[model samples]
Target chain A: MTLTEKVLARASGKAHVQPGDNVWVNVDVLMTHDVCGPGTIGVFKREFGQHAKVWDQSKVVIIPDHYIFTADSMSNRNVDILRSFVHEQKLPYFYDVIDDPTGEWKFDASKGQLERQYGSNYTGVCHTTLPWKGHTRPGEILFGTDSHTCMAGAFNQFATGIGNTDAGFILGTGKLLIKVPETMRFFLEGALPLGVMAKDVILHVIGEIGFDGATYRAMQWEGPGVYSLSMDDRMTIANMAIEAGGKNGIFPCDQKTLDYVNERVAENGTKSEFEPVEIDAAQVFSYDKVFDLSKLEPTVACHPDPGNRKLAKELEHIHLDRAYIGSCTGGKTSDFLAFAEVVRGKTVKIDTVGVPATTKVVRELKEILWGGQSVWQILQSAGVQLTENASCAACLGGPVDTFGRLNKPMKCISATNRNFPGRMGNKESEVFLASPYTVAASALTGRITDPRTFMS
Target chain B: MAHTVTSPVYVVRDNIDTDQIIPAQYLTLVPTIAEEYVKLGSYALIGLPDALYPKRFISEGDISTPYKIVIAGRNFGCGSSREHAPIALGAAGVEAVVADGFARIFFRNCVATGEVYPYDSPVRLCDVLHTGDVATLDFDVDTLTVGGTVYSLKPLGEVRPVIDAGGIFNFARQSGMIAGEAPSH
Candidate 1:
């Protein structure tokens, strides 16, 4: 049996579940957030005819990360919906916030108000919150209401996002249907060539497989690539598994994963050693699929869609007006480390936007890049616009705005997942999706260029 | 009721998104009827916000030659899940949108509101609706017709009857069943 079947079996207390089988499995974890949460709870209540025994309230995670600043009125209204739901459900585990109690930050109340309005507390963003806060463990299936919920697959678990209607259905029944998808193993071999990060590998795979190639299949990554890449990089790849029509994308538990989890939850006394799941050697696979790391280079998915991919070397002569790298997809520690290593001493050209995931990432990268741990000073000298605390702004267009078509169509190299038309800041501005390293290289050069030049 | 009509049809290119079908800017401004919504939103969809959108179906985009029906190419309705796409199409006075493909979710939603109908064969479609010809469909959310004529297509193979009964909520009541009491899955 495949690892997916085995994992499902282990979680469901069954030996195996078939393609056509319908098993009544209890939900292990239930997650909802922000705009959709209120309406979903409302619908769940209406559907069940009354408040029944919830499968487990403790497992319910409600994080509000979308409308962070309440900068726009629409976001404020959305926050109102979340507040109403949090109060109605009396939910407690809603993390993802920046509120500090002391007067050292008087505006903390304003930030707290934003959190109360949006339903986040002194925790953090949802995707980073669940795993970072030690809630997730191996050998479990988690269901969330966000499309990017598949990010949990990086922790070696099966996770998928359902629509609001499906979420309501699950919330009411504590059960959901699954057609135990067949598994597809991606055995990547060879040390990654210079400048090619995990993000590039996944983008190349998507380009080869098309956006929906792995539809209804669980993509399991087991190879030399898994060991070299960091957890954050693994997440960036797995998060977009849904876009490829994958049920989930996962990597097996390794020492790096165990150590990372152990350090964070060590004080919580949480054990990091999970009953690691192993693949059966007898299972007949596609025989074996191999990708040569030496042949692969940095890739860019030209805008209008994520599937419009091409090698960065192919677009070497192309010019760029923006370089963005911050979102749930590529916004993590190692993404910045790879980026700073590319742009540390080099000066960024004018009109470049280099944003990390959080203020924390910015501080780390600033120290790495500017040699002062304060990025603003080095960025001011480097002329790279830095927007801190505006998380997801590089990808989302509320604060750290990208290009507007009115002002000469801007061509950008972004680390965000989707590159759909009008997705960046402009309907006409061309956005190129690439790894963080590729984006950082473009920022320094003022155009779309390959990152292999800077790598050792 | 068994409905049948044969007509030639007009054709639309695929990859039309929901935002194009009905720009969010026009949802509140225009009248809610499918015809007016179509009149107001169709131009914006074809990337002609100033020209054909506010006016009636006149340009080549709205070819009125052989018939009034429309047959679209692949992956129709590819953007946001706003209910406005079907609303605008139905209100824009469009009779039907016969596509080789449709977004699974949007198609399901459209089937619920009785604004559009899905058909398989090109014979019955071409009989009453010619390629590039303007066609009209009188859709009942259960049955659709070309130029006020119903095309003869077999009963739905396997979409939930709920979508046909004006969406899940309405279908539940119309099936002589009460809410909070759906039959076992």
Candidate 2:
């Protein structure tokens, strides 16, 4: 049995379980964001009734991240709906944009300016913030309404996305019927080459597997290569599990996971009783398949499909109209650090955007100095358009007029996941998915240049 | 209890994600009212190539076409876990989807919403079924008959009741899992 099977078996209250066995497992946490939360609330009301209480208030988390900073009335209304629902239900875990305790910035509707408030409250991207807030833990079976929710699996938890209907049902029942998925383990051995991050490794994996290769199966990552990755890198790999049609992508809990969680807890000045779930030694075994990533090059998933990947060096002929580095997949602190390293003193030739994953990331960027300026300041000085705090900006391709939107038919090199047609904006526009290193390098060169060309 | 449908299947290739079913731009058009939602059903698979199938799922003047079944390749509904995808298909009068395989969330959404019945074809349905190919689906025996040959389908198993009850909520209501009058907002 693999670690995935062991986790499911325990969650389902069975001594052993096999693939295709349907089991009703108790859920520990449920998350919904602005884009999906309103729809989920509507479903909950329609099916469970308007006044029906959620199964467990404390266990439910709502974050209004996507479409929050947009001027669109519908997007704002979505956040309003979530706010009202959160208030009406008195949900304990609603993280609003205004909830940022830093109080450094506030969106002033009247002046259309981000003003300083004494004490503001806001949580950025839910995936980045959830683990930071201790909403996700090992051994827990969590469900979210966004496809990227599988990202929490980096904590060794069984987390995946479900539709609004299932979310409503889980809200009412606190249980979801799931078929135990066959696990497909990828044993990534050997250290990644310089200028190659987890994003490159995952892009390589997705390209090899195609978009649907791992459909309906648990994608588990293991081996020494996994240990070489940072927590942020691990999150980046797990975040795009859905890109390969995987049910979930997970990494077994390790010291890195523990250290990251502990540091986050300490930084937040909050106490958590959360303990990392222990792995059963008997469950460890040979993986389904293994890939040596030592020689892996910086890879990019070309236009139209994330599975259409090529070595970044091979794509230097492709010109970029825009370059973006942000999203759950590449908007972490480390991602920004990597981006800054590449574009340190270079001026971007094309439109470039850098959005931190959360408020904490922004704070972290302020600590790093590049060329006598903070990382964020240097990025802005280097002609990178940085957004306030964090949100799923153009990753989903917002309104035609939204910043970072693919308004025109042009090519863009992005660090975000998913390059499906019309994914970032205009259907005619093309998106190349790459790592922050590659994106920054491409942004400086206005072409798909490999990070190694500039890194050394 | 069983349901049967006979129609010319519209064949779509592999990995038909929710984004392709209906792009994010169209999601805001999905109204909360069921009636209004169905009105936008014509937009189902709107992003797909028009040259492939000349007739739209929902035709001009908001009239729906006659295609009731969609035969697809593997990993159908692989992307975003949006109920709107299934809802749009259901609204477009698509009664069932026959695919080589399905993404887990999309499969569960089909069962939970009871909007569309998803049948797993043992053989690649895309290769076996084609546009204007008359096919019959029998939910009772879990089989799809194309031309003169019949293909066995994966059984719904425990999910049958939920599908039979027209969704998980209905099943739960019937089984006494939810008791009491619908809450007034």
Candidate 3:
């Protein structure tokens, strides 16, 4: 049995657990959003005749990341109710839209001027902040109320999304049922060319694996090639693991991971030392897998379904009207730097949208734009729009973006998580999920083009 | 193989998410909604003088949500698979859920997360579902109806076999799927 198998088995409490066994692994971390939090709390008191907290306070995390601007009075009320609950419990972490007057939140909306009720400044998409602060470790199980909770799996842990009830028990008692997931090994081989990115790789994987093929499974990305990828790159891959129903996407701890941990520690006041990664003994992994990255050129998963994938070269004379980069996947400094490196001095021929999750990301982008980076100059010269202070704005269609008098059926290549129908603002519009480099190249060529082709 | 609960189940709107079913702030309240664990959590804090959001926080004794079937609008389970919803609903004394539609992923969560009965109505619109009617869900046929509208929900399938055997874990224990070698796929 491999480490994953052992953890799954132990978490599920089986005498001996094996692959393909479905058990509800105990949730190590549970989180929620305002829209859902209020209703969940309402049900808790209505049902259990009391508050449900009898479990570990350290384990459950709550963040009202979405609808920060208070979509309406009702939405605002919801955020408020969730906030009070977090304050009362003193749950180790709670990122609210309005910070307390006393000032103790990780991100204070009060600090920002434009951080409106539903503005982008309060909290980022839960996925962005979880991994950003080093709350996610390598091998622990994490369950988030949001679908993108699978993003934490970048640390080689089994992370997945769960509904509120599952979160309730994990919050009430330290246990929940879990299914032993079948391991789907995706072998990465050969170094990715300079222009291609992990987003492209993941999108390509999604295209091949199909939207529902890997549902409820663990995607273990391996091969020496994977090690070459940076932690940000790995995060991009793991972030969307949920697209295919996989529990989490993971990569082993290596030098890149160490660097990420070191940098994160220095940035935040958390412990600087890297805790030894936990390994699960007594577990076996399914060998069901696939490979062929050298042949795997940069790719995109097109509209309606993430499963609708095609290589950039497959679509001829592809003209993209919009290219968006910035989700938790593409918002990191590395993604921007990579895009800057590729599109240096080159202006976007098509309209572009760059949305970052955090103020820091915005600040970093501003520096790049003002620092005479070619990409920045080109973006300014071009009509690219930057929608700042929105969480999953472009990814989930919160109207953070609007193009004036554009064609009805707009086609965009983005570096977000899912490309499901209407995931982006335009339901009729076609969206192709891909890497930042691919998006930059697509922006330049007006169609999906091989990112490598644009390289110097 | 069947773990039977009471007959008439409480119906609910589709997508009664973990958050709605069990608010995150209240999760740590410990034995009483009236008591704040430490500081007022977000839900309560909203009622505070300085709330980031509106002040519609549910004060203690805001009419306990009556345990009955909740008839919801279409595309009910259209969000993350937060187990809190179902668990809270179950804890709230909801016998069964009846919805015109359910999010596909959340449907599976109902059966896996707890022992509650999740029934889908076949009718396009569960127009009959009122706020307080009892929801009777028949897992045997995988059907749910409130005030006469039947919901068409998918069967739990593999999960159903375990549920029939009285929860997946219990079923696994009885069948020795974990004790012995894994059953052949």
Of the candidates shown, which would achieve the greatest TM-score relative to the real structure? 2
- Is 1 or 2 the stronger prediction by lDDT? 2
lDDT string for model 2 (A143-226, tens) is 999889999989888889998888887888898888888777888899888899999989999898888877788888888888
Chain B TM-score, all predictions listed: 0.58, 0.89, 0.57
| Per-residue error (Å), model 3, residue A330 | 2.5
- iRMS, candidate 1, in Å: value is 7.0
List model 3 lDDT by residue over A76-162, tens digit each.
Answer: 555667767766677766666555623322333344423323333255667777766656765567777667777777776667776
Range of the 10 consecutive residues with the lowest summed lDDT in candidate 1 chain A = A100-109
Candidate 2 ranges beyond 4 A from true positions: A99-119, A266-271, A284-287, B29-32, B49-55, B60-65, B127-134, B143-155, B175-185
lDDT (Cα, tens digit) per residue for candidate 1, span B3-63: 3333455554544445446543332222222354445534334321222224333455652
Worst 10 residues of 1 chain B by lDDT: B44-53
After superposing candidate 1, which stretches have Cα over 4 Å from the reference?
A10-13, A20-25, A49-55, A96-125, A262-276, A284-288, A358-381, A394-409, B1-159, B165-185
Q: iRMS for all predictions?
A: 7.0, 2.3, 11.5
State which candidate, 1 or 2, has the greater DockQ: 2
Candidate with the greatest lDDT versus the true structure:
2
Task: For model 3, report DockQ.
Answer: 0.12
Clash pairs for candidate 2: A98-A121, A99-A121, A99-A122, A100-A120, A100-A121, A100-A122
On the 0 to 100 scale, the lDDT of residue B163 in model 2 is: 79
Candidate 1 residue-wise lDDT, A231-307, digit = tens: 88788878877555566777777887676666765644433545556767755443247777667889988866566
